[model samples]
Target: MAVVSAEPVKAMKEGQILVTGAAGFIGFHVAQHLLSSGREVVGLDSVNNYYDPSLKQARIDVLKQQPKFSFVKADLANRETTKSLFAKHRFPAVIHLAAQAGVRYSLENPHAYADANIEGFLNVLEGCRHHGCGHLLFASSSSVYGANTRLPFSVQDNVDHPISLYAASKKANELMAHAYSHLYRIPCTGLRFFTVYGPWGRPDMAIFIFAKAILEGKPIRLFNHGNMRRDFTYVDDVVEAIARLIDRPPQGNPAWSGDNPDPASSAAPWKIYNIGNNRPEELEHVVALLEKEFGRPAIKEMLPMQPGDVLATYADIEDLARDVGFRPATTIEDGIARFSKWFREYQN
Candidate 1:
């Protein structure tokens, strides 16, 4: 694999940075971090009802107070609107985080996946392609490791066997991005995130759902009979990774060869990295932490594993650490405590 450049890929000073899906969980945090660092940011989102529009609105409302942050409510699937957005701002760098994001949901609503994750991403790529983007970072998911029983999935691993449409769409994004980068020399980086959870997390996620169920004294379903593990990365850690990576775009590997191509890097300026906690915790252990934080016992309901679900997910983040000079160190105990505090407050 080619070594990533240590130097920053400098963005144009004239235009504001673009963060798609800024109303969503990770995007919101990324935009906030960029704003705090004094970068003018244009946050775009459809504010779709994937989970709850009110929660999305709450995030947008908070960002509205920041002087350096501007919000644009538009669907990336709308090509004209997306085209106009690019023509208007001519963004120097884009953090594309918006997507139709649910594995189980994709089985029922595959069109949504096609519309958002596929079509929406193409629009973002078009914008970056035409507007002279300095760097383009987009979200991929650890779910792409589907059916692969590897213990600490690495970027070099082949992910051609995604079990769900959601994962397939993300894999497609990586391929699409590689094509754009190869053709246009666009510096593209794909981030494969693990199970991200924290304050302002999506309600559909296990942590949030389990917390809500436990609070209401309802049964929290344990998939695969409570025999599953996940690299539950905290959202703050994810944001920090993005902040560090924003400036360090990949310089194409001159040593790369097509005879034995690496999955994580290419001769073009395209790279993929897994940003995860690197610590896989049992689902039961996470439940125990939540129980301790809430001072209540959870009603456990062991159930069969749902379709389009994996038994475990662990990330190999050595590449990320070596390239970015950081690693995720937050313990699940600390993360759960903080999340519990915020969940309690948000409930009121």
Candidate 2:
């Protein structure tokens, strides 16, 4: 399915949209889509060296070419600065995507998760509350489903046993957003993105790492002996879901009951959805696809499952499809081909 440009949002027609973490992979793509749709976008990012700042800068450069796009190099953890930006722009909608990503890295530097994911998210919620931002959409993660043995993780599932601080922080974001939504009546939507991949993807992610290792003739380490499964979603599909959701802010669910509450929805204007491919692929299959894309066999190193790593992730995107009338349709073959092409060009 083609990812079409979003329709003009009623509340956003008069003001610019704020895309936090705009320099980040998914955020960059989301901002670009919004900009291409003729929506004015103010992209905010700390541009920190969590990864290579050069890659973030490259994305910013592309956004800079668009006349309607503006960039703000600021950290969300800076409360005063975040407040100033919100007061200045009064964005109709805020897409909060900035966070300290990576489950494994959280073990090494736990404070980064607390500072960026918790404190930074608090700043965003406060901004939306004070500025009367029409809606607040933030990125949650599939990692939040930690320890749940369900075949496909759903928004309705209880996410109480997060194995990593990163997952816990994301869960905290959802809770905090719910509290703020209840108190301030700010329409809040949390998207639990599955294993998202494609062009301009994160270097630390599995696909990128495997591709790089294969190209350099390095051994690609496979956790759980390549037995894991993932619902690897394409970036364009994720972006399209976000774009379609911009205008459909949740109203307080009238059907919500305190007796047996739906974890995915609240009596307040808050909701959650899992945006994923809904098709789980084996880790071995992913590596094989990368090998084929590069036309080189990968030197594989079998390894035990790392702490905080789940064996599989399959998303139940019923809410996303029913609400947005769309679901991710990209096949792994096509998505990997596009990503490999981009990687080859990017390396050159």
Candidate 3:
């Protein structure tokens, strides 16, 4: 629900936790953080061709170093495989993050979104529902705010129109989760993450693209006439928020009413929150920060707005702050510096 409430929670001391997309940017960070804190983690990833398999492998390499970490290589879309994986490890908590992620890509290949986001998520939800999963935290995206002219997007917003299939698929995930929560009384939490950037971030995102272009002395595309804003939440802050959330499973909202119901709340044990920096940054300003961090100017190439791209994204993380006692406080200067360092290192 959108209602603000909380309680302190200790980390899971025993029982295996399933982390889908463990080879991904945020998923890798989340898995490592859990293993480092003495939690046993079982990672599942399909190792698809959406990006370089090498990068995914590198993340797996890091995770495999932890003694408490185990992994299975398989696609989540296959119901049999997903069921087998769940049966093998009766995880008390499941963090579902694996999916075909990318907006522009979705235009060319809509089937991937349907297969991965929709079908895969349905499989994950079923696994949780049947396995007695205590908590299910899944990744949604700020892109779900497609076509909405809202500033500082809140979880309470009505998101009906999604410009891209990717956004639509993610939106479908939220709806599917809510239905599962209502029908099965499963505890589900959806986090609509803003522009998350840091070390090991996805190569498809603007931060990675801009940084690579600027460093290579190539022209970086400036869409929407360089008039764009995004709330770039750092990876560390996002991981911290997720860590805090895993232990606090949602309870049915007592104040929920059917007469004039809110989309963000339910009488069932379901919840959603915006995980973001709570601040917006202009496109020009972001480029400038990269230029400063890299000590080189980006060769600018102005262009019209992309088909599925939004003009801006601003997250109102009030519920996140109130519930987790945590907020995305990473400054651009520091965040960019960290990213720049990682980029340079990864290249070498």
Candidate 4:
């Protein structure tokens, strides 16, 4: 494992930093961490009614408490607003996490994915390029693995046949980021995050839905006949990996050659890594663990897998550990317990 130079992958310090989707779970947590570190951050969001505006507002309310934190209510898909944001504030480092998430939702309403993920991402890239941001750290997803069928998904893996539109959109992001990195020489790193669960997780995620159904004694649908596996990563761990990566922006790979190019690294200043718990857990075992923590057995309703689904998703985090010397260590039991505790506190 090579440590990304301790030279402290420095970015623009004087210019203000912009964080898109700061009201979302991962974005909110990252923004709070940055604010706590004394960074002057401008958080942006549309406050859409995608999930629950109140939950997003609750996150915004907490961020507003920080003197250094400023909030802006706007949509990322709005090109005018995105352009104006860059013009108004010079951002050195742009962290783009705003997107139309959810794999299944893409099948139901793909227009949302195009509007928010593709069109919205282009607006953000335009802003970064025009503003001359030093480095851009954007959130990618483990779903990009698609039909790769490889255990411990690696960034170096060839991700060509994406099964879902949402996956295709994310894969497109990596290509889009690389093109900019080569053309503009902007240091960019894309994080392929595994299943992130914890306090403030999205209501659409399996953890939240499963926990709710189990608590209410409702039949929880076990997708893939309860044979699914996921590298369930904790949110705090995900945020920590981003924090470590913030200081380790990729530089041009001088050794890169067209003869045998690596998919993960490029001649341009771009790189990607998989952030996961490094251990895949069975779906039913996770349910059992939650049942133990909540003291309620789930009503088993075994069902066939849903569309745009995969049998398993495991992350190969060797590159992350080698670079950052850190990996997600929270076990499913502990992680689920944390979520269960938050559920009890919030739902009660």
Candidate 5:
């Protein structure tokens, strides 16, 4: 594995950064951080109803309060619209976080995944290519590890077998990025995020669903009969990693060899890193923590594992640490407690 040199990061130009999916969970937080750090941000999102539009609007509402932030209501699948936005702004840096999310949902709505993840990503790459964007940082997923039985998923591992369309799409994104990097010399970084959770998280995610169900006195469904594990990374930690990477795009590796090519790096200006907690927590333990935070026991309803689901996911974040000197440190207990507090206040 090649070690990413700890080079001094370049400073981003104020008011020239573009953040897609600014209305979504991680996007919202990342945009907020950029704004707070004195960078002007143009946030774009379709605000689709994949989950609840109300939640998305609420996030946008908060961002609108920041004078340095501007919001654009547009879908990335619309190539003309995306192109126009890029041409109009001529942004130097773009954070591409917009996508049709959810693993199980991908199984049911396969075309949505293709439209948003594939077509949308193409538009982003084209925009960066034509507009001379300095750096393009996009979100990948831990689910890209797919059927690999590896204990800790590393970016260097081959990920050719994706059980779910969502995972396949994310893997495709990384490949597409590499192609662009090789051909156009666009510095691109792909971040494979683990199970991210926190305040303003998607309602379809396990943590939000469990918290809502427990609070409403409804039974919480335990998939795989409570035999699942995940590297539940906190939203803030994910945001910090992204913020640091914004200014530190990868330089092409001169020693990259085709004989034993590393999946995480290339001769082109491209790189891949896993942003995760590096601590896999069992589902049962997560429930206990949530119960403790909620001050009520959950009505557990055990069930078989759903299709398009994995038994466990753990991330090897050594590369991220070596490059950025940061790791996700928030424990599940503290993360859930903070989320629970937000949920209670938001409900009232």
Candidate 6:
């Protein structure tokens, strides 16, 4: 369920909520959802040319219309700038979403991951630590599951063997957050997001790329020879999950034991949740849905498995449901149809 209809589980904390990467796909939706619920939001973005600057600007332009929304354009990698941002705002809760995303891109440009994901994340932690944030919720990735072959990846799964630099960076964020939470007592929650797709999605993502190719009568590349599967969670579902979790910060488990430590929770105010569809859908099936929605046939190009890419990703959202009382429920078919409608209008 979207936040538009669902009542907020907890009232937002006083003062403006700081949402980094507000121009980005998921961040934009998160910011929008918060603003819709009568909350003041400070949206920040570097507006880099990761995909298309215009698309990011378009998202910002929409957010600008909200009287309660304020926009800031700054690079998170810059320590002084990020510090200044936190000092200026003194945000009660910080939703750190800005990062150098994409597993494949990390292979070509390893430095970017270090700059944005690692260095930038550290800056966020320092800010939250010194500035007194009530809760720090940051985006992690299912890619952190690396070599683990477990179906329906759980938050408690050991994620030490990340295959890609991007995944490693995300894992690093989780560790960094946990340490801060343990040492400084800042409440932190890490969200391991699966394949997030919807309106205003990244141009580099499979659904966006395939949508363009299918409409233009071009062949769509299916990595892993069209056999890959993903827990495709819609953007609204993700925003809903985030909206619900904002007020409910983690209170460290008293039962947590160092002798048999649980990877998902800590003795400190730290926790992790896998926010995904909890149902894996095949790559072929996703394309079929797109074709059905757009009323077009796709030309297929099967390719061997790419480096730093997993064969499948399924989310074990039991922890999220138990704790937050929510799980991503949008089916791939429904998500594709909604995406196709938006793509048509956006393309025009």
Off by over 4 Å in 5: 1-11
Q: Lowest-lDDT window of 10 residues in candidate 2?
A: 1-10
The whole-model C-alpha lDDT of candidate 1 against the native structure comes to: 0.93
TM-scores of all candidate predictions against the true structure:
0.98, 0.97, 0.97, 0.97, 0.98, 0.96
Clashing residue pairs in candidate 1 (N, C-alpha, C atoms within 3 angstroms): none
- Over the full model, what C-alpha lDDT does candidate 5 score relative to the true structure? 0.92
* Superior by lDDT: candidate 3 or candidate 4: 3
Q: Give one digit per residue, the lDDT tens place, for model 1 in 8-95.
A: 7565444799999999999999999998988999999999988999999999999999998999999999999999999898888899
Indicate the residue-level lDDT of 325 in model 4: 79
Better of 3 and 6 by lDDT: 6
Backbone clash pairs for candidate 5 read: none
Give residue 242's error in model 2 in angstroms.
Answer: 0.3
Q: What is the C-alpha RMSD of each candidate to the true structure, in Å?
A: 0.9, 3.0, 1.5, 1.5, 1.2, 3.3
lDDT of all predictions, in order shown? 0.93, 0.92, 0.89, 0.87, 0.92, 0.91
Model 2 regions lying over 4 Å from their true place: 1-9
Best by TM-score: 1
Question: Tens digits of per-residue lDDT for model 2 on 87-150?
Answer: 9999999999999999999999999988999999999999999988988899999999999998
1 versus 6: better lDDT goes to: 1
**lDDT string, candidate 4, 1-348, tens digits:** 222456664565555678889999899999998888888889998888889999999999999999999999988888999899888886888888888899998998999989988889988899988987877899889989899896778877899989999999999999999999899887888889898999988988989989999888899888878989989999999989887877677877788888987888888889888989989999999989988988988898899989899999888888888878798999998999899999998889
Write candidate 5's Cα lDDT for 219-323 as tens digits.
999999999999999999999999888888788788899998999999999999999999999999999988898899999999999998899999999999988
Better of 2 and 5 by TM-score: 5
Count clashing residue pairs per candidate.
0, 0, 0, 1, 0, 0
Q: lDDT per residue, candidate 3, 113-179, as tens digits? A: 9999999999999999888788889999999999998797988889998999999998999999999
Clashing residue pairs, backbone N/CA/C < 3 A, model 2: none
